[model samples]
Target chain A: MSLTILGCHSATPRTSAHPTSQYLEINNKRFLIDCGEGTQVQLRKYKIKFSNINHIFISHLHGDHFFGLIGLISTFGLLNRKNDLHIYAPTGLKEIIQLQLKTSNSWPQFDIIYHELKNDQSELIFDDNKVEVYTVPLTHRVYTNGFLFKEKIGERKLNINAIKENPEIEICDYQNLKNGKDFVTKNGTIIENKELTFDPNKPLSYAFCSDTVYKPEIATIIKNVDLLYHESTFLKDRQEIAATTKHSTAEEAGKIAKKANSKQLILGHFSSRYTNLDLFKQEAETVFDNVVLAKEGKIITVDNKTFATELTINQ
Target chain B: MSLTILGCHSATPRTSAHPTSQYLEINNKRFLIDCGEGTQVQLRKYKIKFSNINHIFISHLHGDHFFGLIGLISTFGLLNRKNDLHIYAPTGLKEIIQLQLKTSNSWPQFDIIYHELKNDQSELIFDDNKVEVYTVPLTHRVYTNGFLFKEKIGERKLNINAIKENPEIEICDYQNLKNGKDFVTKNGTIIENKELTFDPNKPLSYAFCSDTVYKPEIATIIKNVDLLYHESTFLKDRQEIAATTKHSTAEEAGKIAKKANSKQLILGHFSSRYTNLDLFKQEAETVFDNVVLAKEGKIITVDNKTFATELTINQ
Candidate 1:
């Protein structure tokens, strides 16, 4: 799975800085997460195909997280898109979008299916043959959720060498062999499935945690994930403000990542007050070594076995 | 008065081009008109003082015209603005903003006074000693109104050269002279007010007409303004589409400017399909000689006498 950061700043969008938004491409599906204002422009700037965004996930109702949604829907109408778009967000988003459309007297040519999230516990929101998406309920100033995207185990690979050793193994038996079935040769010789095929790549997973306060229980739900993205809105020095605002500091995010035992941690949603982002990484590193700052336009690739080398922590 | 084009393109915002939004500074008051999706960034890019804007005028409920409003309002709350904000828009905007704020469970520290327009005729929406803003109702798919900003005639200027001629004029009489009152000297000689002072720079005015079809009646409401900005969403070739979309072609906008006898005409809201904007200028110039394309970030200065030399239209 590859994750692209479209925006990461907290609070509001500035001329050079953007708010929270990301694009994830995994299992042949394109997912847009937390569309802030100017998200369409950022998508265009990053050259992501607008039509390819089939699903949009909003973490909360904050303007910084979902203000750009209505415009994107309107733009889709203008583009005459016919594919159905699914929005998994808080219950109130549908009302907001419908009201805007009602006032404008324009409706989208495509159908918008709203999957309203209301529960405050981990629930499987989306599941397919290749992946499953679950919500990680988070503590915030308002109702919020972080999503965990986990790839499902695929069909076992075919062992061509083992198959070549069996003369009675026909092409029709290849399917059964790949499904973890042992082959019995014509002369009563047995071939083990493990010796035939290597294990498929370990099921890769990525968890997105943002706009939430420091909650250790979240780490338990997202433990041992290949990659973890957590919001670090402030440094340790501003922990009081962070606590009052229900936002996490860099050190807090780091502690969560370390407790979860995630392979890699991405720190994002930095407050606009700080110009240098390296401080976030440094603060996070005090608790967790594998921490990367989520910069706008940066792309991180997560594989099943390890984090991609291209996006390794700078340190 | 000075008008700054934040975003002028019609319909949806693109990567390099923005939608409809403008900043008008008149009589020491800053006004934001038609805030599109990326207007906040545009404001930051142009370095306009965010706190100076106390009034926002939204033409209609179209996404491209007013989607940026909530974000802007939320940003104001984030900045802890204390001044009350006045929003002049259609009746439904209040509910939309309130719903989003309610869902987020956050209210602005400042008060939002909404002046909901439900009329279909010209009406004075705002009035003060220095300036008066009137709504010019226009025909569109949705309820839309253009704005006419007229500077109130100021106190007569005290011509220093002419005042010096009267040696008996006391400092206390200066206020009376500036207020256009004749000063009676101690010898019972009447010092004519006209002789002592010249008229203050003739009251300047500007009119913003956008997102409307080719309607001639609007010209009557905004007649003879110093500067007029009209939406020209299409070229002459796409006049049929413009008519169907309730938008104006370049020639249609030019005709409106010509009929209104505006001192200067600015054509904006060009469709995104056409990248070469010179054709819009060419089509508009065919009917109106004083025509300038509304390029983003271009500031137009309007005085009582004529348009400023800095923004002189190329012949």
Candidate 2:
């Protein structure tokens, strides 16, 4: 799985800093998250293929989070996109997009299917053969949701040496071995399933949480997540402001990450107030030992056994 | 009158080229024209104060013309803008803006008065003591209108030497003299109005024409204008495509400028297919002697005496 942070700042987009937006590719399925203003230009800067994105997940209706959606949809029409596109967002977003299209008198050349989310509980929002996406309801001024993407477990791996020693195990019998079934000989001799097949790589999971207050309940739903992205809008010193705005401080995000027992945690959505961001790491490190900051054009890659990040300059 | 080209490209905004948007400071009135996506950042890039802009003019509902409007309004709310905002746009824009704001569950702190235009003929849309704005109806795929900004003719300039010679003329009568009234002395001596004062500089005028087909009617409306900005989406070689798309070629723009007898013509909205913009100037210079190319961050300053441009690098 690979994730690219297109923008990660809070509030308004600036000359250098942008708002919330990201590109996620998991299990070979690409998704766009929270298209803030200037997102299309960012996508172009990163050289991401626009046609690869089939689904978009919007966290909420905040201007900083979803203002660029209509422009992206409009560009799709200009580029003559013919594939079906799916959008997972709050219930009110449909009316907003439709009205804009109506006013412009231009609709997308392709079909747009909106999965307007309204539930207050964590619910499964998208499901495919290789991946499943669940909603993480968040606490904010208005209704909002984060998304959790999980790769489905695959069949067990075949033990090539073990199978080669057993001549009775024909090529046709390989399917049963991969299915973790025992091998039976003609004379009623049985071989254990574990001896014939090894376990496959564990499935990977990523949870995206943002624009929320210090809600510890999220830890339960996202427990043991491979990677966690939580909003750290402010540092510990500004906890009061974070609470007042229904945003989370770095310490609060750290507490959630620790409680969830995530393998890795990425801090993002920093407030525009303070130019000095080193304090965020110091504060979050007080509670959690592993923490990293999210910057625009940063790429995070994760697999069954390894997770790493690399920063690439776009400007 | 001064005009700043924030963006002036055709169709989708690319990594470098942006869409249609400009900042017009005419008669000391700051106005934003055609807010394409990423315009707020462009405004910041050019260091144009957001507070100075109270009025916005959208040419049409096309995304390239007005996609960045909602984001700008949202930023205004974030910045705690207390000044009232006036928007002049097509009839359907109000519904679009309102629906987006409604979905976000947030409204501006200041009042937003919308001037929804539905006129097909040239009509005055905005008039103040200092300036008057008229809409120039154009032919496009959708209903679009160009804007003509005219500075109101002010009081005639008082000839300081002539005024000082008449010691009997009181300060209170200075207003009358500036109003071009003939100076009358107590001894019944008469002085011609022209002798007492010089006529005020001809009211500086600018016509912004864009996203339209080659139409000569614009010449009649903006005759003898100081500056004219006409869409030159294509060169003369692509004249057929220009006609089919309802866009004007560089030569067509030059023809209109020549017919109007405009002091200077600025060509903009270049198609993305062309890499060498020098051809645009060459094509326009065929018919118009004085023509310049519009580039992002290019500032065109227009006064009664002269018209000048200075290119400022933003990237």
Candidate 3:
């Protein structure tokens, strides 16, 4: 799975700093999360294909989180996009979008299926053969949610050398071998599935939490995730402001990452007041050593076996 | 008067190309017109002070015209602005903005006064001591109105030398003399007003029109404008598409500019399909000689006598 940080700043989009938005690619599925203002432009700057993005997930209804939704939806219409767009956001998003479209009298030709989330508990929101997405309920100024993207366990791989040695293991028998079934020879000899097939690559998981307070209970739901993206809107020095605004400091985010036992922690949603991002990484490192600061255009790639081997940390 | 074109593209915002948005500084008044997506960032890019902009004029409800408004307003709240914001838009805009703010549950400290427009004729919308703004109604796919910004006639200046020649012109009579009144000597000798004071610098006017069809009647209302910004969404080769989409071609924009007797014409709202922006200027020049194609960072400053002397044309 690969994650592209389109924008990582909090509150406002400045000259080069963008608000919250991310593009994730997992199991051949593309997902856009938290579209802040100028997200469509960020997508263009990063060269992400607009048509390939079929699903959009919004963490909250804050302007910095989902204000760009209408513009993106409108652009898709002007491009003559044929695919149906699926939006997973808060309960009031649909009504607001519909009101804008009605006011303008320019509705998109494509279908927009909205999956409004009103549930207050962690639950499965999306499921397919390749992946599963679940909500991580968050505590914020308004109703909020964090998403957990988990890749499903894939089929076993065939051991080519082992299968080649057994002439009775025909091409048709390869399917059963991949399904982890034992191979039975025509002469009544049986071969173990482990000997005929290799184990599948380990599945990976990423947890995205933003615009939320320091909720320690979140660790239980996103435990052992390969990558965890947590909002660090402030540093260790502004703990009081962090609490008042329902935002977490870098130190708090690191504590949560450490408690969750995540393989890697990606800190983002920085307040524009801070110019030295390395301070966030340093503060996070005090609690958790495996921490990386998120920056616009930074890419983080994670695998179950290799872990976060390819990461563009913003120092 | 100075006009900054933040974005001038017709439809979707692309790389280095923005949608419709402009910043106008007339008589020390800051006004934002047509805030498309990424406009706030563009304003920041151009170093325009956001806090000084008290009035915002939205042409229409189309995404390309006003999608950036919410984000900018939200940013203003985040910055803790104390000045009230005045937005002049369609009737439904108030409801839509209110819905988003209500959903987010983060209301700004300052109040937003709405001057929703439903007029179909040239009626005054904003009247201050220094400037006046009127709606220039246009035919489009939806209810849209262009804005005409005019600098009101300023107080006449007193010729210091003429005042020195007449000791009877006391300091207390300066206000009357600045009001275009003649100086009367204590000996009952009346002096002509023109001889005492030179005429004030000619008042400047600008007419903004966009996302409209080829409507020649627009010239009657915007006659003799100092600067006219007309939409040139397409070239003459795509006149059929322009007509069908209710947009104007460069040639049409030139014709309108020529017929209106505008001193300068700024051709903008360009389609993204065109790479050579000079072709638009060329097409416009066939009917109007003083034509400039709009670029993202283009600044067109107009004066009464100097005309379009400080212009940064794309080509």
Candidate 3: give the TM-score of chain A: 0.97
Per-residue accuracy of model 1 over A39-113 as CA lDDT, tens digit each: 998998888899899899999999999999999999999999999999999999999999999889989889999
lDDT of 2 by residue, B1-315 (tens): 889999999888887788999999888888899999999999998899999889999999998988899999999998999999999998888888888888888798988999999999999988998899999999999999999999999889888898888898778988998888998888899988888788887788999999899999989999998889999999989989999989999999999999999989999999998999999999999999989999999888876644554445555
TM-score of chain B of each: 0.97, 0.96, 0.97
Report the Cα lDDT for residue B282, model 1: 92
lDDT of 1 at B244: 90
Name the lDDT value of residue A17 in candidate 1: 84
| Clash pairs for candidate 3 | none
- Residues A1-315 of candidate 2 have per-residue lDDT tens digits of 888999999988987799999998888888999999989989988889999878999999999999988888998898899999899999988888888887777888799999999999999999998899999999999899989999888788899999888898899998988888999998889999899898977888888998999999988889998888999999878889898989999999889989999877889999999888778888888998778788888888886644554445554
Question: What fraction of correct interface contacts does each candidate retain?
Answer: 0.94, 0.88, 0.88
Count of steric clashes across candidates, in order = 0, 0, 0
Task: For residue A271, give model 2's deviation from the true position in Å.
Answer: 1.4
Would you list the clashing residue pairs of candidate 2?
A: none
Which of the numbered candidates is closest to the native, going by highest DockQ? 1
* Ranking according to TM-score, highest score first: 3, 1, 2
Higher-ranked by TM-score: 2 or 3: 3
Off by over 4 Å in 2: A185-188, A307-315, B307-315
